[model samples]
Target: IFCSQYMSWTRNYGVQGTIFPAPNFNPVADAQMLAGALQGFGCDKDTLVAVLTQRSTAQRLTIAEAYQSVLGRDLIGDLREKLSDHFKDVMVGLMYPPPSYDAHELWHAMKGAGTEENCLIDILASRTNGEIFQMREAYYLQYGSNLQEDIYSETSGHFRDTLMNLVQGTREEGYTDPAMAAQDAMVLWEACQQKTGEHKTMLQMILCNKSYQQLWLVFQEFQNISGQDIVDAINECYDGYFQELLVAIVLCVRDKPAYFAYRLYSAIHDFGFHNKTVIRILIARSEIDLMTIRKRYKERYGKSLFHDIKNFASGHYEKALLAICAGDAEDY
Candidate 1:
């Protein structure tokens, strides 16, 4: 149900991020400004949003350190106490180191009653091997639990198996074999064609272990062999979270920024407004490919992410998200 059009823009994004290090940045000055903003009667929500959202994540961490050293106050803690609602959520998400943030989100997703399978699939499928490694380590350090084990416990059947395979983070990187792509595509087609028993293991092995580049090739080969898009085949073959995760991987392999752009659009329109999903994507991708995401959103949806967000959200929450988005559609 998602667009699979791989754009030329996805191939080359050398710093296509909306957020960047502020020119002439001074962490101490930013920390002090934040301190003053939060000092008096009530809090200066505007200054808090301005300083935190404008800075890069690394710069925000530095400001946090400075806030702790110079003022003996934790920046995140102060912000949490001062800000409220989704605005606070965005500010707090910014303060975390990326892996920590991912780990935190993962833990949050799986913690309570029903698990957030989409959140799990989103992070695990999109991250690189190194990023997955760091997130695993952070998950252990922060929560004192194995991420794979928790996910395995939370999920079951082939879905659990596929997630476990991705958790290994051993997908080949920067390498693709044309011959193997053809072979894997045949394997996938046969597995899908099988009518009896569970071919889920075979499908998961190929889908989860292949490098994204190789998977892209496999997808092309699959099309040539089966005369059907792999995504359509999966939709026809599989069901539930397993199918969703596999499609997500394909989408990311095809075009990560576009996958996230679709995700952003879904978050806005799917329910009333999925603030957590919106906050997570905006904060996580701000320094990665949000600019590309913005462009793709406009191309695919015929409107700017900023414009949709402005209409979906209000008050400080909207202001903070808008800042991270940098500007409207025309800015890109």
Candidate 2:
């Protein structure tokens, strides 16, 4: 039951009616607003050590500007003096331009004898549409080479094609119609029941091809006709790695944040922790939908995500993850 609406208000009024007055402000006031927020959050010299270290480079600049205006101090200089080790390194990395992040990731993957497929997957798959477009442009601008060409050279087959397609921003445009969505779901179910290659193809087509908004409608129609949630149906029908792959696609399509919440829960629920998965999911989604993930985590699990993460994991990694998940990743 999602309801969306756009609201508009006009400040001017004619005749005898009273007009709503606009709030007054100045540049100093704007600075105070940002500064007050950081101060209110207790983001002082010591706290900036953690904040700057954990956030991305773009995030640090915003904070630094705010700190300079409000506190009459330099955030980066303070952080340099107070922090050290891995934390300092992360903070310094966050200060680089976005191009630097992409180039650095690529450099790390290609620096040695071979390319890291996981790094390629993590970056290309997780970026938003606009971010990926910007990255493609930036990659060309920074390296004087085609980003897609580099990715193709590093990988092969359908997986490579899929990554490149995503990076190239070539997917179906958004579509929405209750009737067509129901038909698509029926077709999907029939293919799934038959255990044909069409099932996998359709799954990928719907999951990877459609916009999230359109897929949400399709998923709802699927639920109506199938009398079961898509996740449950996929879990029941598929097996082994195929099942995991299908489930990941469906979950990601359904609600990415919810998918992440489940992943976070899975990371620590079993006897031993899948630390890599935890770290990967946290880092990948930290700036994407992590606040939404926290909301979904609370709703689905009936517990504060930070509290659970603290209970399950330990040390600075846990703290960094929690801070990022707490909506401190970046201003953008």
lDDT of 2: 0.58
TM-score of 1: 0.93
Error of 1 at 3 (Å): 35
Q: lDDT tens string, model 1, 68-99?
A: 99999888888888878888899899999889
Query: Over the stretch 302-324, how does candidate 2's per-residue lDDT look in tens digits?
Result: 98777877887655555565655
Per-prediction count of colliding residue pairs?
Answer: 0, 2
Off by over 4 Å in 1: 1-13, 195-198, 327-332
Model 2 misplacement above 4 A = 1-59, 62-93, 96-127, 139-147, 150-158, 172-174, 194-199, 224-228, 236-246, 268-288, 311-319, 327-332
